[model samples]
Target: MAAIEPEATGFEPESAVRKMSGFSLKPAERRALLTILCALLAVRILAMFWYPFVDSTEARYAEIARKMLETGDWITPQFDYGVPFWGKPPLHTWMSALGMKIFGVSHFGARFLFLIASLGLLAVCYVWVRKLRGHDLALVAIAVMASAGLFYGASAFVVTDMAMVLGTTMSMAGFYACLADKSSHRVWGYLFFAGLAVGLLAKGPVAVVLTGIPIFLWVVIGNRWRQLLRLPWITGTLLTGLIALPWYLLAEAKTPGFLNYFIIGEHYKRFLETGWQGDLYGSAHARAKGMIWVYGFIAFLPWVLFAPALATRGRQVLEIFRKDRTGWHSYLLAWTLSPLILFTPAANILPAYVLPGIPAAAILLVSVWAGIFGQPGRKTRAWVAVSMIGVAVVVFGLTTVAFFFPNTLNVRSERELVQKALETSPDIAINYWGDRSYSAEFYTQGRLRYIADSATLEALKSNDVRDALAVYSHDIPRLKDRLEAGFVDLGRFNRRHLFVEPPLQ
Candidate 1:
């Protein structure tokens, strides 16, 4: 990891705080680094196009967006038609649905907006790091962040967390820019609240909590309380409300009990209660308290592997937090640690929750790397670049493997199964015996339904449409003798057995 010593120097013109940094990269070296970063990004985009949306999480959201698109109800994202989904706001779904409108509802269409959002967050962080350090350091930061475990995995995956990450990044970047600028700070000040609005819309109140943590800690620890007044508070709150409040209000009006379920049940009970049973749409993801820190370690990988780079310059790293007037280093530390700290006590968490902190962690790591290995020679710099490139290549390789052998990776998508079922019963309404698959809904365009009982199955059949049953091998015995005797089994697709109406003897 140390072979390619990263090049960086602190550039805090607002307070003139500088870090002890390493040698600058030559033009050829910089170009090489840039080329690698761009290539890796292209690979990430290709992964998005090549891979199918896996079952449950990715396909669930994609199905919800597809439903939203079909229903023309822009106000609420439905878990199923007539069932309003209050788990999250419509920001990610809105964009994904818009992407589907323009591109058609395919893997690329459903996932394209997420890639745009992830790259947009990277862009914001890249510019912020460039202002604090130079081109080389910024390059190191984005390279580390973009290839990190959770960030890379979620780059184009259809999840709500990416939009929230973008919100947190924008807020963190705009806040620091406001601190750094010598004049004309009003625009940046408004940007801080604009980020708040985005975050609120993207996830919920948690976005505000994520952004506020670092700012509060930096202000209190640095005793820089007077800086708060410089920002435009009165108008900013109004702007945030204008953008985010209407949706909350409108959702509650459209569907009663939405606000109560979403705000209190989702944000409050779900966080503090393990195995929280209040979830209306899906089961809660519960982990042990403080598990978020462990997830943080996993999510920040490849960069987390380089902790010794920062530890080697422990004194300089500590001194920046204690002595730097611009609050940049301390701010980065606070920003990177904020999500981990906040979710440490929460019983429900996922690895993607760690994403908001990763960009700051990468920037901070590269800054310390530069501080420790001052003027690392050309050979050492090349080694550092190779180390980073190797990690990224490994990530791309994993994606390639997933593209080729999804089943090997335990990737669950009902696309092929649905397609195979259609060939067997072209006009038959395919139904599951029990339990629904979101990927089936997405692949079949919301036509897939589950048989709650014999009555529903008979009712589907009475519509003069032959209703085929796709039952799991294990679940085949659960059906009545009529179904088991009256149907022709049409072979297995994955674990499920598709059955069509019996042939006349």
Candidate 2:
């Protein structure tokens, strides 16, 4: 007995038991995790590939990126008409350009990079939730985010929003790592690098604002204020400048008023001025009082049912402050509230503008779910069922709306028509009216020469009529004035007026 007891003493039985427990993975749990990730990805891919690109801005962005690839000019982004356009930063264009290069410039090819970026976002969210809450909550957060209508829409399109979301989420994940793990200096490096890279690639300095402010506030409130100085602020700032400055500099040199239009006009004026014109947003789109709440409700659907529980947890965090005044909960509150306050005052607001807040919302949701339903039960099952149904309805509704009531005249659908019209009448140079000019260029793969405005029309009038097709929106009659004298109407197609130049009289 004494010898047996000595042998047992070589390793503590409790320690051995605990170590063994860590290695155990139940078959059912593994199955559940795989099933959830696969299902979420399936739904996302289906919705993304199901519809062709929509007209106006979405198609325009993709077309511009395609041109960038075709021309081999990454410095200056161009529309179909070859004008120096700088409405948005070049990160999205760069990504799309790469996609075009790899995938050969189809709609799917142009949007492929964004799709990959969206998947990166999903992967980041899963890792982030697992680190912050737990594995179970990570699954729920990812599923909810992947299925949300807005998220799905953003993911499917080749717009800047998805890039912004992916970059911002990466910054947040890096920031969280910095806060959670103090012993590792690499964590702060990751945070700084992510912030800088994302800032460069996404939305300029605003990316840093969206990411840094919350982190700063969290550190200060957590009584880790001094830790701020520990981060490599100077190096990080320099790095960010290095990454972001070249594009702006090159763009400014190539295009006049680029800085003013992008930084001051688009970013600043759009936020402060109510009636800022153009496709960005206007008074009609701005609903300050109710839009955030509505967006909040919609963005966090199914999971929003746990908001009351989060409120309760927040109250508990407040009470804890009364006693100890130091905890992660305070940091969570800061992270959640800061961005909401910052973006709410902007003159132009879209639901996607608040995407950076999704991570915080996910964290809060996980916290509430953990507090209320710590273990599986009837309540948990009910919550899960309701969430699944809510997400299903949103996904189905979006698919129905996008596919059945398609905007056929949009840049996406009308591209081929423009191409055919151009090829059919190659003797005359085509002039495009309204926004269709950009899509026409994309469809022709930049081969068909196009002129913008009456001046270009006047210059090109002497060109052979058979080489050109004039396309104008049905709504605008002034474009008809630019048509050459002998041009004949080629009949209307897809709500666009096409004119063909006749053979010389």
Candidate 3:
């Protein structure tokens, strides 16, 4: 497992960046590029503060991290007060907790690490692609990634997909570096393994499957199987084990049977079984198999629309695939297709499942365009500059509007209802009936309570908690009737009603 000098990965050294690449940008283009970057940066910062925390997903993760911060238990992710969450590893929660510690427990703090991971992923893409392709193509790819709808949205959200993408992309890029530059073998080899470790922490075996399988398949197809021996697998494996295993082992030791649920129930059955009955924490989506393929286009929106333009380069792309000895096309194809292939037969699917491969798709799209068009001429540069500025403007305006707009979309109604309850009775206990809102828990600092049934509501009616706040849907006839009798109607938000008991004294 010693670091052996690996054979060429079919990449050629790129030349110095030219004027069109923005390395030494022309006056107008430089101003334009600077404006675009500044605009994007401003919008991202504004989004951090302006956007509402989404329910069921974003708020769930933020609450778990908040709970971790609250209870001082960093090992097991807590779904409720004492309920252990085995849905994902603690890496994401741990990162957010650290963010909360630094920035205070708030929405921005919860998503801070995710935003950093997204930016780091982009930086990695820029450096890696710049080394393989010329500066112009690298910049194009980076621009496309930054402007892509899903990538842009995922960048600001508190989700595991961005962290997962960071790990997988880092691992793959490191491998590419090892193959592309023999002199950098030790550095890139170690990076590859380090990323593998990160990926494991990010999403468990699925990371290995998504990343390792693609590299393995590409090597086999390219007849470069022997290159595997050249990698520092022994050291790499040890490093990965050191970083990823201790958490899993410690979590299992703390909570017996965690490993069983996480690995088998979450990883296996959740994917293979439609409406998976084994899921202990939540129900499965059970979308038709291969829906991920369709989601790919949606996730790659605005850019995927350019597929027709890219289609004209089919002969060029095919030739690159058939003739390129550097394995560039092969590696990209593998990277892009790996997740789609793996998830194609799965019962449950989400756009985030295809996230790790998005960077690859963007890179591939730009590379094909670069291959066909060669360097950008004056007209092309002007168009590129305009497009970059225009997209940035649109994204900034869209985010601004989304922020100022009311939560009429119903997306934030649950949060609004919870807020209303809190506003109604700050001194009394604020609770919900019928269901729970994790977002509410996050906003209330985990003080929100749930009244499960009529029995609980009846018991609470006479309890010393005079003028307590409660939130429930008006459609729940039983709960509604009981609420009206004991609690004065305060107000309404969306379909949920806010009530204050004892007629507010």
Candidate 4:
């Protein structure tokens, strides 16, 4: 081949240059960006449709949102029966309720809002990394987050995790902006708004504890303690109270013991007790070191390989701060590590509980990538290319297994019983083995009516039902033994021995 022209090698030809320098994108580059964004969106959409609503938590949240929409109740979020749901705040419910109103109570509809939130997260990551690192490294961070399994799973569900992620990301971004503009009251105002929004959306006051405390400590310890009092505290507090008060007031009125149960009992007591924990993993304080390792492995999938370099670069950045007496890197490090330490005392922990750390981790990884590969060098380019290819391969394999694998992999026979119920009585009320009804409702599209033996049964006894489905478990044996006369077993659906009512003769 002929030798490359100097203009062609170093820069575009003068005549071919159509726009401003530095930020101007060529046609091919624009197309590539659009393609990548579209592909990510398509993956999220497809995954939302493909995954069966897993029961218990995810399904329950969706059902509660659906009911909230149907009943036009925004104050108290309920599921199955009108039992108190003290697990999470109501922002996710609000989002899902909106989805139900718009899309009319489908899995895709309930989860669509989360998909949008995930997209917002992805966009935030891109902007954040671009600000700290360069465009190339930002792209790498985006790719890593897009391909992570936990990220994908949460993005495709109607859960608080996505909202938490969005709020936390916003908080982190605002923190960074506030640091950059300490003299500007407007920046502080924005930071306060973001913190308030996140606090209301997440596990209440803990949001401020998790985010603000670390940031404050970082600033104070770094000799910038004077800056703390400069924030627009009065205005910010009023704004936050305004956003958060209505729900608390309404919930307190509707549920007599809501404050005692929610704030003190559920939030505080759950953090202290291990036995009452509802997490798939045990309590936070009781978590083994291995659990944290596993969380790192899963949450940073396809990107975990780069973690070593990321950590090394993060340390170097911290070293620079130590020498210069600036606390920027220290703030990030504290934000990342504080929650890990704080939540360790809680009775329950989840991979998503540590999700707030994701942006900080992404920034670290992007910085590392930039430091190693920002220059035009053969070895750097080769490493970057190899890493990209490896990540793409792993992501493709995992998504293939996750999406195409049989239901037998993740779901149990209880789910199959729900599936059978869907086929037979698509609209009949179902009495569950307690809070376990969502497993059925998720699969059945909120079509099954729930009857808890103690409360709902008394209310639903008047309804006409020649046959009813009772979920059998050790606790609900009475439902199996005390059946109405002329009841015929339709067929055993699964190992749990679910039976359907036959048509009245």
Candidate 5:
């Protein structure tokens, strides 16, 4: 992708009021993007406390990090006391553990690193796009991304996707810099490798695939086979290997057979095999291949409403399917489309899996917006305001539900149950049977334990551990006999129930 010389375009608008897609830039464009970014962050920060840790994902990650802090074992993330968490590398856990150490093991602390990564991603996207596309488009890109529901959601949410997105953004930006600008400095090449290293630590080999495949496709399509030589491959590979290999080696050494489980089971089988039957630590999502694109619309949110405008670029979009014009448009298309293609056949696809492509999607939208509204004196300001208002309405509606009527959001009730259990027996350990809530483990600072069935639970009650609290859901009716014989009811909240052995007189 070659940069179009500014002289050839003859459209050098003044910085003070650059007209884009018929909308005036009002000199405060940079401030507007920043203001939007800040507002998005404020909403997410509010959400950190307003919502409980979502179980099976957010709480799971936070609990593992808490255990890492507790045991002082930084090498291996722990799902249980001795169970090595093989799902992901420990980079996120390391950052989260440090946050827990500083902020205390709470939701804010657990999510602090993701917040920073999200901000870093914003900064990187703005800087990188402004460098290539210009300040106006860069500002629009940031504004569009900040307004996106998934991109904004991941900012304060406890997830590894933002970290991965940050790395992918850097890697793709660096590649764009090197490939599009023949005179690009050595730093761009270095940033490319740095991104690879960070991405490897962030999400393993999947990062490499996500970063490498697009570039490979772009180079082959553009016939810039020579551009490959210009990159410092040997040095970059060495740098990436040096930065990324140690932890993997250490993890494999610490936990025998970790490589097979993480690499083959998680990376390979998870994508290729429906349901990922090989998964050891977690269940596979197992959705239809088309759901990846369906998630794309949801992930991009209000921007996807501009589908008609995008369809006008139908020929350009199809160019990604074959060798075509070699320019920033093609690069953006490759960067945006590759992920959809890569994940289309995946057995377990997540909305966040498409996050790496979001920056490119935002860029594409900005390009389309600029083209469609490029005519002078087009009153687009009101439309932009309407878009922001729509976002605000959605955000306000969600926050209201979270704050005023939390129980209505049953997806997060597990953590509320755990919080109730802790309120009753703050000093006693909590144990559950039938089902385990990761939120309980996190809220309890990893003190939540599990037993197999009524017999094991009764054995604990017969011992001095009788003071331990037993927590479960409405499913506790199945264990009515056990509860009647050995335990006294504590309380019930929503669908959750709590029980404890009677105190000796």
Candidate 6:
């Protein structure tokens, strides 16, 4: 693939940037850009290693992986010891479990694979864009994508979205290769299905929908329906089924009703119905319809600077489909907009649902820049500095506050409490006196117990078995009222105080 005409993308081709599109960055600017990218990645890696997994999302997933490893139930992820978590598929859990198995189950172990997944996406962006538009603009695209709030966070954050988005990107890339070049299409065709398998396993059928919409729109609008035949559809569908169906079958067998809940409740009702209450694992996050558009802007805030230009630019990206020179414009535009379009009418949406479109958004933003400005210069460096460096500074500030101030952000991690409890005496099991702490469950290697009643608490106290209780801050007075004196306060974490009974004299 040669350099795509900057005009062939999202905006008018008559701009000064079209002339500068061929220009490579000066060595100094190139080094600076590379340095900034490396530094941003380094910061995220540090945060991944340093930060504790918080409750309700990160720790929830981490503990599930820990339980999966402990129980050896690879087919179904558990919300509790035996209860199945039907909320999502098992790909992200498998990755984290594998990481924990290989690296030892800490934050880094659970989260390491996501970092790899994100970097792999970045590499794909760089190579694909480099092939289409040369080196300079590719770097610009990478910077733009890497800095987007959603992408930056998802780079190492433990969520199913990154893997699902990676699959979408793979589908886009592999589909483009199959459609655009007939000379070498076999492997790329398979890669397209492989992405489908990944997306299906990582999230669910939504992966196919997210990738399919752009593909269908692009193929239909271009009248390149025949080009899709170039793909190995019969075999591709088989491959996807081969990879994804086993888990679905196994999960439903292990916990019947998974298909009905996941396929119908999650995929359909969760999105269409406002304030949907059918969710089993978590509450529905129902926002106003079309808030996804707002989330799209916020997610891509760094490069959303060109949003005004997009008013005209979107039409131009579509205009190129008719010429069908390479189908690149059609591919980019459809892939980028598909998520927003899919979620536009859904009342239940999360900002994370906006993730699938970030890569294509990054690509189009840089294309818009090249089509409009035509070359990297002082403004480019300043923009990267503000975008990249400014984000770094905020991360640093948050890290400092998290470590020093400790309670300002009210981080919901029980790692510190677990560590202190073991230090007090690693021999006894600890109980959470208030809400369940998944982080505690994870940090304790499933040794955490919940105090179900006062009789259970008194029995342990009377038995001469020195016990530990991680009492939530709000429950401290109640705990004191239940068991007065004869306890040592070990210390406190965000919301919990670890109190251990003193040995009987």
In candidate 2, what are the lDDT values of residues 146-264, reduced to their tens digit?
65556666775777777876777777666555544445545545655665576556666677677777776666555565545545667766776777787888888888777877777
**How high is the CA lDDT of each candidate model?**
0.79, 0.62, 0.76, 0.60, 0.74, 0.81
In model 4, where do residues sit more than 4 Å from their true spots? 1-37, 132-136, 182-188, 277-290, 310-326, 376-406, 412-419, 425-435, 443-498
TM-score quality measure for candidate 1: 0.90
Distance from true position, residue 415, model 2, in Å?
Answer: 5.1
Candidate 6's displacement at residue 261, Å, is: 1.7
TM-score, model 5 to reference = 0.89
| Per-model RMSD to reference | 4.7, 7.8, 3.4, 8.1, 3.6, 4.1
> 153-242 in candidate 1: lDDT tens per residue?
788888899999888888888876765554645776788889999999999999999999998887787676666776788998899899
Query: All candidates' TM-scores?
Result: 0.90, 0.75, 0.91, 0.77, 0.89, 0.90
Ranking by lDDT: 6, 1, 3, 5, 2, 4
Candidate 4 residue-wise lDDT, 139-168, digit = tens: 656765665556655776777877877776
Candidate 1 vs candidate 2: the lDDT winner is 1
Query: Model 1, residue 286: what's the lDDT?
Result: 81
Clashing pairs in 6: 17-373, 17-374
**CA deviation > 4 Å runs, candidate 1:** 1-23, 320-323, 375-404, 454-466, 479-484, 502-505
Candidate 1, residue 95: lDDT: 83
Best by lDDT: 6
> Who is ahead in TM-score, 1 or 2?
1
Best candidate, TM-score? 3
- What would the per-residue lDDT of candidate 6 be over residues 1-505, giving only the tens digit for each residue? 2222323432223234324355467778889889989988888888887777788788898899989988988998999988999999999999999999999988888999999999898888887677556677878788889888888888887789999988988888887766555455777788799999999999999999999899888767767665667789899989989988999998888889999999999999999999888988778997999999999989987678757755666666444345445566557878889999999999899899999999998887777655555565687668767988877777767766765665688988887777777887768768777678888898898987888677877776676666888877777776686656556787677788888888656
Report the poorest 10 consecutive residues by lDDT, candidate 4: 1-10
